[model samples]
Target: MKRETNRRSFVKLAATAGLCTLASPAVLAGSHPEQLAENEETNKIPKKSWYPLGVFKNPVLESVFLFYVGSTWQRLSDVGECFDTASRIDEANDYSWSDQWIKTGNRLKVLGDACLKEHHEFTAGESYLRSSTYYRAALHHYPDPANKIVKELSLKVVKNYKMALKLMSIPFEAVSIPYMKTELPGYFFPAKLKSNKKAPVIILHAGRDSWAEDYLWVAQQAVKRGYHCLLFDGPGQGKVIRIQGIPFRPDWENVITPVLDFLKHTKKEVDMNKTVLMGFSMGGFLAPRAVTVEKRIKLCVANPGVLNWTASIYNGLNQIDPQLLPLFQAGNYDLFDQKIEEYMRTSSYVKWGITDELWKYGVHKPSELIKKYQEYNIEAVAKNIGCRMMVIDGTGEEFSVGEAKRLYDALTCPKDYVLFTEEDTGYLHCQPGALAIAYTRIFNWVDKYIDVI
Candidate 1:
């Protein structure tokens, strides 16, 4: 593979916006994916609690058992649990929590500014806007309700959404992924845009611990290239997963059908005839499954796709050791009263076990969530995906490379596989390795099958 050695130079910003620091593992070797490979190989995200019936009977956990043999992202999932602590903070009043939320939002803004001004790509700026959206959503659910937090938070959410939306060239929309029937309280982002003529549509499914906002970078790219993008949060994603305890549903029919129906009825620009569904991380698994049933999806794209959720969870659980399995299984903070930082060190993967603050917010492990994944295996549906497909994998990504390759080989569609190296780009999970290169490849591929048809 030809490596792009001028990675730092290639990491450009979007004009004179601002400079935001990139979390490059180049300086921190321990944080690099390759460094933590040994732990990932041996440690299994314990199915002890994840699979009350044992790993064999549970297909999802069984799949997880197969995939995450050795991965650094699982270890980082433990450490990165610290990011959730920010969610635990009070965004409106509690000074400590509020300050943290503000700082995080501001830091994201700085990142966005850096992208807008320096990189010209403005991914950091989009990231900042995305984080701001989450922070505002958190405020909407603040326990106090002293000041009608929802109303106050909605204003900020709208502001951030508008700021992010204005930067793009195409029409944008926001949506609150309905969870258990209600629009997830404060979370919102644009969903679909109406085009005068038939325009190719992109349906985006978010990854674990992600929201619709995470797609700002990808959506912006799609719109500029003349595609209408639909970004939505699925169950167990973003606030719905974190706040409502709605675990993922493998029979994605329940989650995406309504969204598709809405698009079919509401948007003219969305070419129902030329739609593609794309997923990253967990969505990698999700988009594939959706395409099986939703024939409206003419093509599928899995960016660092996931074939098995059980394996994903098990891999994550393995990093923390089996001793703490009971705490995670119980789904409450009955075990220890450790602060968030210590919780990071002690728990198998910091967020695997439910926290007290989280429970106080009504978050709990609905065991059904795990069963949902177990019940909905995509391999059974892979043969059903008649659409042409594409899989993008980074050599540096630790999450699901082998699994993605297996799916790519199994897929019967006219498909292509794109790979990236760290020396050529940064170590990013969703092909952020060299985004310009990745996006170029994606658009070029779409143009090929799209125009000829």
Candidate 2:
């Protein structure tokens, strides 16, 4: 069949990408864009704007802090140590967050360098992973789209990730997945796939605006639990967006389908029937959307399940002006934009949010972004998902208030609705603060259905 040829062809092109070396993070990340694309947005969301998430008072700071804290089980984060640095940040200063975090990252990188020189492989790897994690937090609020510091910190993330990979006990590969006109960057942890046949494969999909390395802890957990894992930067994410300028597309089945092909071709021992599509954050939307069309997956996990991104956007629009949604629906775009522009002048949250969404969606105007997101809704095809589904809802979801249950209610297939309360550590969107409990429940549910043998 046509799909068969695509699978074989991917392995051929992907093999030429070669196994990346520890000294070559640039090659692993990908070549630089011919000319950097312009990012018109600025980080207008002020410190402590919306603090509903957890721990930290600011939403951005809370998310970034948990982005580091979530990895502590793998030794990639030191929660107590981070709290020390978190205290030194000056909320009145806009750049204070990145400055303190990047400083901590720099200190850890120096420690890693000395440990590597002393031949303490384990200690060096820990230092490198922790350093990479801190650098990642800094990137979240780092301003100036054209600043070289963005690229500098990005490369540091990849470099330290590679360095830590060198010291890992399991096999790790810096892989490239061939897509439409280019390749997608990925990490392949084969685990014991070759010797232990029938190994289940977990494909971890990153959220909007996140790098694969940002969620390396997810792959670490999967591999630790005996699953072959793949973490990749798809269109409009990580290097693909920054380096290649491809924006996000709604038909994620087009992306997930090819990834399945690549896995089937390369890892002969993997149990395709036991495949689990585990999505994080925005991936809650992307994963369910992909499963509606891509049926090869046997199990699908939507953490903080989202039924519709456009609906969520409309929710914000409604609050701004009860007439805003009606204006958009009536196609009065110029007037709608005029009103939105007026609102953006005063609301940092609205300004940064709309600007960030425009950049990620790769559209010039907010109207176009709305049209693009319209393709991302899963209501029409919810029944098309043939695989087992688990919809994860959280206690403190700032963006998606009731969307998870909405998705659960819409699905006609065999499904379960999971609520992550304060007790479950599934407090926020992806349960970054309580990663261990999140992963434990997820995999444990899979154990009940999938036969390892």
Candidate 3:
């Protein structure tokens, strides 16, 4: 009720101005020509832009942010429309909003992070469940009771989802403050086939611009093999904090502590000691950060660990148009008014070195965060980690393959590095298409070092 009231009030304030309805591909085509392939139409919207849902909500800003967030249905909708109109835009350019939706998403992520921080304390708390369910329902338009997707969820799946949601409902208490209070969303899956002992638990972490739901297939795969899995949207990772507004922290031990404690306290069918932490892309950075402090975490695995966060951002930003840099440095949109192409090209969020999102989410720049990163330095702590480890890297990945090797070499415990070439596995970043291979390699490596039984 509070959220709906807030959204309605905010929507009125944000979208009531001189706003435009739809953005023609013709406008975007001229500026985004470089994005087109040689065979593609220079003036047409890429096939990727035509959503089955008819651009869901706001067509303007969602169109832009979609490129950044990988074009999900929600951003293409009305919520996104709100973002396009909320910002203080340049009147000269005929745009009403500034960077509004991105900020909204970031703020929601922050509030969610705060809520989860409380939820972490109340792992089994009733209020937390009520609040979280409300949060999700609010986001999904409280899907109609007769919706087929809602109907199709079997009672068993519904029960499990509710069970997990119940676990997530627990409210945070002040007394639990001393312990780590990590912010990550999790998915729980029970093993399918029976095993000799409790099922192995895989803690899933995804990369930047990735959602927790993105790894459902992975958890499903693990479940089929009698492995229990938990996937959480950690700070800066998934919906709980990424799109909602939670900031990244260097001490990931805090981010992971809640889930680890939850697993240890409940879940009889799971062998907490058999737990493995797996991360992809930026998660490569996150999982390693937590593994060092949480000794109970049994395995540290990454799909191409991001060795240098700052460097990566720098590279991404440098690849964009050079002319847009002035608008970003000045934090002015005069150039945007002159030309939409100029503004987006130079947008700090669209640039690499521009750490605006971190700031927007209440985090320090990469340079500062990395200082905290050094405290949990995976390479330095790899020697201290007593658990088995696995590192997977795609040869064609734009990020460093060397970091994975460095981690593999530095790990004092038993470790394995599995490299998949384009020829062998069509994996880039998190072994995208080769998840089966990735899982097999990880389990095989872990089995060799520590018995899952």
Task: Return the clash pairs for model 2, or none.
Answer: none
Write one digit per residue (lDDT tens) for candidate 3, span 83-147: 34333333223212222332343444344446557665333333322222223322221112223
Whole-model Cα lDDT of every candidate shown, in order: 0.50, 0.71, 0.47
Q: Write the per-residue lDDT of candidate 2 for residues 109-156, one digit (tens) a residue.
A: 999899989989888888888888888777665544346786778778
Local lDDT at 136 for model 3: 30
TM-score per prediction, in order, is 0.60, 0.83, 0.53
Best by lDDT: 2
Note the clash tally of each candidate. Answer: 35, 0, 31
> Residue by residue across 1-453, what tens digits does model 1's lDDT show?
112221111111100000111222222232344534544677833111111112222222122222211111221111132344334443224344434544555555666677777755435435545545546434422334334543444455456555655564335555554434665322212334453466787777765534565455567667767777777766655545544455555677666677777677766556687777777766777787777777766777877655664554334333333433345456544442232234433322123223222332233332333333355456666777778888776654544536677777778877787775554453345643244666677778887776545
Span of ten consecutive residues with least summed lDDT in model 3: 13-22
User: Can you tell me which runs of candidate 2 are displaced by over 4 Å?
Assistant: 1-57, 193-196, 347-350
lDDT of 1 at 447: 70
Report the C-alpha displacement of residue 443, candidate 3, in angstroms. Answer: 4.2
